[model samples]
Target: MLNILRSHRISRFAVIGGASTLVYAVCALALSRGGTGAAMLPATAASVVAYAIAGLFSYAGHKYFTFMSAGAHAFELPRFALLNAMGLATAIALPVVLTERLGMPAAIPIVLTCIVVPLVNYIVLRRWVFRDV
Candidate 1:
């Protein structure tokens, strides 16, 4: 347990993931609420936009910091983007299926999306996207 707690990659992931999640959650909530001068967006729309914004940060952080991989960007970048596209799909679909179809609140879908994306992403990033690490 202590060894697990001391893992360098996990430590880096926690820092990077926290920052990226903050970006995602803030954008999502703001867009959903139409904060400032922005027009209100549906939960699904907000999520897609948020995921796109966050994906960039996540990619750079995971590639350079968390995984510390020396793999060619040409190979890794498309794989990273593809994985994030999968994450974005989850971010979009959770709101549609949970809030629209099941009558749950927008908040629930957003929170669930936040939880699911990172867990799945970490596994895939290790196994495929940043496999060289």
Candidate 2:
């Protein structure tokens, strides 16, 4: 009963979340690449831009595919955006604290963002942002 629904929901969430992750990684890595030339950006800056793009994809995917939400976009979108902004803040801060302050490689924060953001998002998205209506 509840377990079945939860299992099905988890699978759908994985599909959409995976896509969003791919979008974030591609954009972040691409933007972070190249030489010190103007075309390149610092890892944290690239991550910020990439996450913004990925967040939009995630909202659409989670709305239609993951949660199959039928709720009003006006209501759902604002909440969804707020949830993602928290994730974004964490994503932005990780590099600042980890790479800049601690002198860890940028990859560490980038990898942490990939793993941590989705985990937190799933919990919040299921319970709050895209809760069953």
Candidate 3:
């Protein structure tokens, strides 16, 4: 068990994932808060921006550290963008829809989204985006 944990690329992916989540949180907070007394952006818009910023870090980290891909980034980046788009849609759209339509607390859906998005992203990244060349 310990050997599997130490040897698996999933461990590396999880590390990069933690970093990416941190990036998203920082960017989202900054954008949504909008600095001392300035008008804040819509929450959905702020979250989308944050996801995009984290996507860049995700691509670089997975390419270099997680999957160790040496493929041309010209090919990889587009695929990575597509993956991130799906995740962004899930993260932003679900929370807004659940809050607006079903009357659930926005935080509930956002927290759920955070869990689901990473699991899906890990599968997609391992099988598709960062697959061995």
The number of the candidate with the highest TM-score is: 2
Ranking by lDDT: 2, 1, 3
lDDT of 3: 0.76
Task: Report the CA-based lDDT of candidate 1 relative to the real structure.
Answer: 0.84
| Clash total of candidate 3 | 0
lDDT of each structure?
0.84, 0.85, 0.76
lDDT by residue for model 2 (19-106), tens: 8888888887778762133537787898899999999999998999888899998888999989999989987998889867887766
TM-score of 3: 0.80
* lDDT at 119, model 1: 89
Ranking by TM-score: 2, 1, 3
Candidate 3, residues 1-133, lDDT tens digits: the string is 9678546788898899888887876676566553224426655676788888888898899899988888888888889889888999887887578755676654455566667878898889878887767
Better of 1 and 3 by TM-score: 1
Q: What local lDDT does model 1 show for residue 54?
A: 92
- TM-score of each model, paired residue for residue: 0.87, 0.90, 0.80
TM-score of 2: 0.90
